[model samples]
Target: MKKKLLALLLLFFIGNFLAPPVGHADQWGVITIPPGKPIKIGMGTMLTGDYASMGIDIKHGAEMAIEKKGKILGHRVILQAEDDGCAGPPSVAIAEKMCNDPLVVGLIGYMCSGGSKPASDIHNKYKVVMISASSTALELTARGIPIFFRTCWNDKIQARRAAAFALSRKWTKVVVLHDKSDYGQSLAEDFAENIRQKGGKILAMEGLTRGDKDFTPVLTKIKPLRPQLIYFGGMAAEGVLVARQMKRVGLRKTHFMSDDGCYTEKDFIQAGGKATNGCYVTYAKEPDPEWVKEFESKYGPRQTFSPQAYDAATILMMAVERVAKKQADGTLIIGKKALRDAIADTKYNGITGEIAFDPYGDRSGSVVVVYKVVEEEGKRFFKQMAF
Candidate 1:
């Protein structure tokens, strides 16, 4: 009888241990695995085609962080990078593939704001956490998606800075030029509104297509306004062309200003050459000496959003590790919902600075840095200013 009672007790203990507690194990058993492989996060950005420089830098930054942290966020991490061609359908396709991939619980990239916005919608639909290293459209954050976030400041802050910079200089008459793309138009409208609110008058507003070469018509109309300043909201290609054309037409008195596109890339200098002098613009952030040292070791002397990109990947991975730690047997289970929750709650220091996303997936207290041009020996170098 004693031996039988002992055997029954052992059977009861084994049954209790094997049977998982109620709803969690049964409901989630199908999707669950025994902490299979390392957590995999998909990164989507423009690794090719135009604007590939920014994309390359973004990838380098993230890759550097992953290399330092090791794959396994305490377990292992896997990063799959996809190039979206920085356009419409290609970007959508990339996002769709990442969303469907079981291993890719989170995503980081699609630097273009237009691409980020559309891709983010798909990410949210599939409950995949996604973050941007460069997209700064205010509307991207205005909608309040729980899983969407950005490492850079939004267009609103940039527009406000531009308005304040122009207004403070007593430049009452201003001309606005944009590329007619979403980024350009959005920032132009915001800058216009802020300038008006701050008592600066907009003398004229014009736009050009992305690849349009001839700006004679737009410049001719804008010149008549005799504006003190010209705010061009477009990429470097058009911006440089506009500056050179304006110089040709003797609109030298009007100082030019642009947003991130002009500052972040080297195109404005390369395109306009000597003509890019005296132009002012805004940059995302200044590089830290220590971080630059590290970046130089990995990537050469190319300036890009390496720090922010690194942070975005690191934050997502950290969250995945957190989820893995809380598993039943310390198994690393990197599912979509778990990864999303981990990314959503990240509060850590990034390569640029402290990173803590607001409810709308926007970083709080992120300021836009303004820059001025100083040309030497036919080369352009931007001077950072605190405004």
Candidate 2:
């Protein structure tokens, strides 16, 4: 009898160890937050690298939104920010770390599309919702990941609009360039497709490494193509280099245009100095003046996508408030699927404009604006141009 009992005890221990941990969660993926525990939101962004400015701006925006909301259902809301490195490998690691933490309810970012794409698979497996403020690659949503949502406009919309704007200006002969990143290459391809559909001539399509500074060779080759415009699909880090080297390669007469990746004044216009003058960039429409004033008062000089980040955080918190159930002992029980559904049904007016997500988790009614880099009072700034 003693030997039989020992065998039974061993079997029980093995079963318990092998089974999935559902101590604070239900079979339906409900996360239980004990009394006095704060609701944690994970933020994975580029905190260290060339794109740090954009990520820092996103962090500040989310911080402001959380501070204004104060608490959710008598529980303090906390943001756990992690540096995603704006690349694939770091993003996957961050996603794994955040998803494994039981306290982490949702996420706010994976700033670069290259990072977001791979990290998204991990988030979906854990049923963790992530809303991006800047990853604009169209394929990010095309995969039908229910947990992935973005406040940024799709690259297809921006590319089409840019092509139309270029055609309107009679800049038919153009060279398309990308930084070989998921975000940059996709945007360039879409823009090139749109240009072809609109009867514009694509002189040549080229790809470059992200961190490389020398683009004179490519520019020199393209200069002979006599393209009227060079549309670059990359961030300010490489955009500034390409713009500066164009002059050295004797492409001074070629017009330079880029996407929201190069929209910042400090990085693109200011960094490139005279090279960025008259350069055209595509970005989402500006937010409310009153809200901008309030944000600038605290954060000082907003970078791209801050407003979108604010709205993404605001929407997530609001969804959490709507779905979280408080138990008799003051514990909070939140169903992961319920929270995602609540966010999908969101229809709130945000500082950036009306907020609504489509079936594919893309923001509805997103407007892309074209701006020109110009010098005013000896300082370079982006001026909104009437398109």
Model 2 superposed RMSD (Cα): 3.7
The segments of candidate 2 whose C-alpha lies over 4 angstroms from its true place after superposition are 1-28
Which stretches of candidate 1 lie above 4 Å from their native place?
A: 1-38, 73-76, 325-331, 376-379
RMSD of each: 8.4, 3.7
Over 1-387, each residue of candidate 2 has an lDDT whose tens digit, in order, gives 999999999999999789777444543488777899999999989888898888898899899999999889889998889999889999999999999998888999989999999999999999999999999999999998999999999999999999999999999999999999999999999999999998999999999998898999899888889999999999999999998999888898889999999988678877898988999999998998898899999989998988999999999999999989988888898999889999999999998899899999999999999999988898788999999
**TM-scores across all candidates?**
0.87, 0.93
- lDDT to native, each model: 0.77, 0.92
Per lDDT, the best of the predicted structures is 2
Q: On residues 1-387, what C-alpha lDDT tens digit does candidate 1 reach at each position?
A: 999999999999999889766443321221232465565668888787656777888888888877778756345666788987666677688889988876675788877877887888888787777888888778989887777888888899999998898888888799999988777889998999999998889988887888778997788777878999999887777887888888887788988899887775466666577788788888767766788888877787555577778888888767766664336664544455655655667778766787887778888889788888787675568888656
**Model 2 TM-score relative to the real fold:** 0.93
TM-score of decoy 1: 0.87
Backbone atom clashes (below 3 Å) for every candidate: 5, 0
